[model samples]
Target: MADYDLEALSLGELKKMQKDVAKAIATFEDRQKAEARAKVEAFARDLGYSLPELFGTETKSTRAPAAAKYRHPENPSLTWSGRGRKPQWFVEALAAGKTASDLAIS
Candidate 1:
Protein backbone atom coordinates (compact mmCIF):
# COMPACT_ATOMS: atom_id res chain seq x y z
CA MET A 1 0.00 0.00 0.00
CA ALA A 2 1.30 3.46 -0.98
CA ASP A 3 1.64 6.04 1.83
CA TYR A 4 -0.71 9.03 1.44
CA ASP A 5 -0.67 12.40 3.24
CA LEU A 6 -4.33 12.25 4.35
CA GLU A 7 -4.24 15.83 5.65
CA ALA A 8 -3.35 17.35 2.27
CA LEU A 9 -6.25 15.87 0.27
CA SER A 10 -9.33 18.10 -0.30
CA LEU A 11 -12.79 16.91 0.78
CA GLY A 12 -13.66 16.01 -2.83
CA GLU A 13 -10.37 14.15 -3.24
CA LEU A 14 -10.91 12.35 0.05
CA LYS A 15 -14.47 11.36 -0.87
CA LYS A 16 -13.31 10.11 -4.28
CA MET A 17 -10.52 8.16 -2.64
CA GLN A 18 -13.00 6.67 -0.14
CA LYS A 19 -15.31 5.62 -2.99
CA ASP A 20 -12.36 4.09 -4.85
CA VAL A 21 -11.26 2.18 -1.76
CA ALA A 22 -14.82 0.93 -1.15
CA LYS A 23 -15.13 -0.25 -4.77
CA ALA A 24 -11.72 -1.93 -4.63
CA ILE A 25 -12.67 -3.70 -1.39
CA ALA A 26 -15.97 -4.88 -2.93
CA THR A 27 -14.35 -6.22 -6.16
CA PHE A 28 -11.35 -7.80 -4.37
CA GLU A 29 -13.44 -10.79 -3.29
CA ASP A 30 -14.82 -11.18 -6.80
CA ARG A 31 -11.30 -11.13 -8.27
CA GLN A 32 -10.14 -13.71 -5.74
CA LYS A 33 -13.14 -15.94 -6.51
CA ALA A 34 -12.44 -15.70 -10.25
CA GLU A 35 -8.75 -16.61 -9.67
CA ALA A 36 -9.72 -19.61 -7.53
CA ARG A 37 -12.26 -20.75 -10.14
CA ALA A 38 -9.61 -20.44 -12.87
CA LYS A 39 -7.20 -22.57 -10.86
CA VAL A 40 -9.90 -25.21 -10.25
CA GLU A 41 -10.88 -25.16 -13.95
CA ALA A 42 -7.23 -25.70 -14.98
CA PHE A 43 -6.91 -28.61 -12.57
CA ALA A 44 -10.23 -30.07 -13.78
CA ARG A 45 -9.08 -29.80 -17.42
CA ASP A 46 -5.87 -31.66 -16.59
CA LEU A 47 -7.96 -34.43 -14.99
CA GLY A 48 -10.07 -34.73 -18.23
CA TYR A 49 -13.15 -33.01 -16.74
CA SER A 50 -14.62 -29.52 -16.79
CA LEU A 51 -16.05 -27.61 -13.83
CA PRO A 52 -19.47 -27.56 -15.52
CA GLU A 53 -19.20 -31.32 -16.22
CA LEU A 54 -18.65 -32.02 -12.53
CA PHE A 55 -21.08 -29.37 -11.22
CA GLY A 56 -23.75 -29.59 -13.96
CA THR A 57 -24.01 -25.80 -14.03
CA GLU A 58 -23.23 -23.54 -16.99
CA THR A 59 -21.68 -20.10 -16.52
CA LYS A 60 -22.81 -18.88 -19.94
CA SER A 61 -25.93 -17.12 -21.15
CA THR A 62 -28.06 -19.51 -23.23
CA ARG A 63 -31.26 -17.56 -23.68
CA ALA A 64 -31.62 -15.67 -26.97
CA PRO A 65 -33.04 -12.14 -27.01
CA ALA A 66 -36.86 -12.03 -27.20
CA ALA A 67 -38.52 -10.10 -30.02
CA ALA A 68 -40.38 -6.92 -29.13
CA LYS A 69 -44.15 -7.54 -28.73
CA TYR A 70 -45.36 -4.15 -27.57
CA ARG A 71 -44.50 -0.58 -28.66
CA HIS A 72 -45.15 2.90 -27.27
CA PRO A 73 -47.91 4.83 -29.06
CA GLU A 74 -46.07 8.16 -29.09
CA ASN A 75 -42.60 6.61 -29.32
CA PRO A 76 -42.36 3.94 -32.00
CA SER A 77 -38.75 3.20 -31.04
CA LEU A 78 -39.66 2.24 -27.45
CA THR A 79 -40.58 -1.48 -27.34
CA TRP A 80 -41.03 -4.32 -24.87
CA SER A 81 -40.93 -8.10 -25.26
CA GLY A 82 -44.01 -8.50 -23.01
CA ARG A 83 -41.87 -10.32 -20.44
CA GLY A 84 -40.78 -9.46 -16.91
CA ARG A 85 -42.07 -6.32 -15.16
CA LYS A 86 -43.94 -3.80 -17.32
CA PRO A 87 -42.11 -0.56 -18.13
CA GLN A 88 -43.38 2.76 -16.69
CA TRP A 89 -44.68 3.98 -20.05
CA PHE A 90 -46.45 0.67 -20.67
CA VAL A 91 -48.14 0.83 -17.28
CA GLU A 92 -49.18 4.43 -17.86
CA ALA A 93 -50.58 3.53 -21.26
CA LEU A 94 -52.72 0.77 -19.70
CA ALA A 95 -53.91 3.28 -17.06
CA ALA A 96 -54.75 5.78 -19.83
CA GLY A 97 -57.47 3.41 -21.21
CA LYS A 98 -55.13 1.71 -23.71
CA THR A 99 -55.46 -2.04 -24.02
CA ALA A 100 -52.53 -4.45 -24.50
CA SER A 101 -53.78 -5.09 -28.04
CA ASP A 102 -53.37 -1.36 -28.80
CA LEU A 103 -49.68 -1.61 -27.86
CA ALA A 104 -49.07 -4.87 -29.71
CA ILE A 105 -46.77 -4.43 -32.70
CA SER A 106 -48.48 -5.23 -36.01
Candidate 2:
Protein backbone atom coordinates (compact mmCIF):
# COMPACT_ATOMS: atom_id res chain seq x y z
CA MET A 1 0.00 0.00 0.00
CA ALA A 2 2.87 2.39 0.80
CA ASP A 3 5.92 2.99 -1.36
CA TYR A 4 9.12 3.07 0.65
CA ASP A 5 12.30 3.64 -1.35
CA LEU A 6 15.39 4.46 0.75
CA GLU A 7 17.39 5.53 -2.31
CA ALA A 8 14.91 8.24 -3.38
CA LEU A 9 15.73 10.69 -0.53
CA SER A 10 17.27 14.07 -1.36
CA LEU A 11 19.86 15.86 0.76
CA GLY A 12 17.19 17.88 2.57
CA GLU A 13 15.21 14.71 3.25
CA LEU A 14 18.37 13.08 4.60
CA LYS A 15 18.98 16.04 6.87
CA LYS A 16 15.42 15.80 8.19
CA MET A 17 15.97 12.12 8.83
CA GLN A 18 19.12 12.91 10.79
CA LYS A 19 17.23 15.48 12.84
CA ASP A 20 14.49 12.96 13.61
CA VAL A 21 17.14 10.42 14.71
CA ALA A 22 18.74 12.99 17.05
CA LYS A 23 15.35 13.81 18.60
CA ALA A 24 14.69 10.12 19.16
CA ILE A 25 18.05 9.78 20.90
CA ALA A 26 17.24 12.71 23.15
CA THR A 27 13.88 11.19 24.04
CA PHE A 28 15.56 7.91 24.93
CA GLU A 29 17.94 9.74 27.22
CA ASP A 30 14.99 11.45 28.96
CA ARG A 31 13.28 8.12 29.49
CA GLN A 32 16.47 6.67 31.02
CA LYS A 33 16.66 9.64 33.38
CA ALA A 34 13.04 9.10 34.45
CA GLU A 35 13.75 5.45 35.20
CA ALA A 36 16.77 6.41 37.30
CA ARG A 37 14.67 8.95 39.21
CA ALA A 38 12.05 6.28 39.93
CA LYS A 39 14.75 4.03 41.39
CA VAL A 40 15.99 6.85 43.61
CA GLU A 41 12.46 7.52 44.86
CA ALA A 42 12.03 3.85 45.75
CA PHE A 43 15.34 3.81 47.61
CA ALA A 44 14.39 6.91 49.54
CA ARG A 45 11.13 5.26 50.63
CA ASP A 46 13.05 2.25 51.93
CA LEU A 47 15.26 4.61 53.90
CA GLY A 48 12.13 6.07 55.61
CA TYR A 49 12.45 9.52 54.08
CA SER A 50 9.24 11.18 53.02
CA LEU A 51 9.06 11.82 49.28
CA PRO A 52 8.99 15.57 49.88
CA GLU A 53 11.74 15.37 52.46
CA LEU A 54 13.97 13.43 50.11
CA PHE A 55 13.32 15.29 46.87
CA GLY A 56 11.95 18.66 47.86
CA THR A 57 13.11 21.94 46.32
CA GLU A 58 13.20 23.68 49.71
CA THR A 59 17.04 23.75 49.82
CA LYS A 60 17.99 25.32 46.54
CA SER A 61 20.84 27.84 46.46
CA THR A 62 20.44 31.05 44.53
CA ARG A 63 22.30 31.26 41.26
CA ALA A 64 24.80 34.03 40.68
CA PRO A 65 23.63 36.91 38.49
CA ALA A 66 24.33 36.33 34.82
CA ALA A 67 25.59 39.86 34.25
CA ALA A 68 28.74 39.32 36.33
CA LYS A 69 31.64 40.92 34.47
CA TYR A 70 34.53 39.00 32.93
CA ARG A 71 37.28 39.69 30.43
CA HIS A 72 38.03 38.20 27.03
CA PRO A 73 41.35 36.37 26.79
CA GLU A 74 42.71 36.89 23.27
CA ASN A 75 41.76 40.55 23.42
CA PRO A 76 42.33 41.61 27.00
CA SER A 77 40.91 44.98 26.03
CA LEU A 78 37.43 43.44 25.59
CA THR A 79 35.25 43.00 28.65
CA TRP A 80 31.82 41.38 28.98
CA SER A 81 28.89 41.31 31.35
CA GLY A 82 27.57 37.82 30.62
CA ARG A 83 23.95 38.70 30.10
CA GLY A 84 21.85 38.22 26.97
CA ARG A 85 23.58 37.69 23.64
CA LYS A 86 27.26 37.93 22.80
CA PRO A 87 28.92 40.92 24.51
CA GLN A 88 29.14 44.28 22.73
CA TRP A 89 32.93 44.37 22.85
CA PHE A 90 33.08 40.90 21.31
CA VAL A 91 30.70 41.92 18.56
CA GLU A 92 32.61 45.12 17.86
CA ALA A 93 35.85 43.18 17.69
CA LEU A 94 34.26 40.72 15.31
CA ALA A 95 32.88 43.57 13.24
CA ALA A 96 36.43 44.91 13.09
CA GLY A 97 37.46 41.46 11.75
CA LYS A 98 38.39 39.16 14.61
CA THR A 99 37.99 35.36 14.61
CA ALA A 100 36.44 33.32 17.47
CA SER A 101 39.95 32.13 18.31
CA ASP A 102 40.88 35.77 18.93
CA LEU A 103 38.67 35.75 22.07
CA ALA A 104 39.50 33.83 25.23
CA ILE A 105 37.41 33.06 28.30
CA SER A 106 38.44 35.35 31.11
Tens-digit per-residue lDDT, 15-49, candidate 1: 99999999999899899999999999999999999
Tell me the whole-model lDDT of each prediction, alpha carbons only.
0.96, 0.75
| Candidate 2 TM-score to native | 0.44
All predictions: root-mean-square deviation over Cα?
6.0, 11.3
Shift in Å, residue 43, candidate 1: 0.8
lDDT of 2 by residue, 1-106 (tens): 5575758999889889889989999999999999998898899889988667966766679887665365665666666665668887777778988765655453
Worst 10 residues of 1 by lDDT: 56-65
Model 1, residue 103: C-alpha shift (Å): 26
Cα distance off (Å), candidate 2, residue 48 = 1.9
Q: Worst ten-residue run, lDDT, model 2?
A: 65-74
> Candidate 1 clashing pairs?
none
Highest-scoring model, lDDT: 1
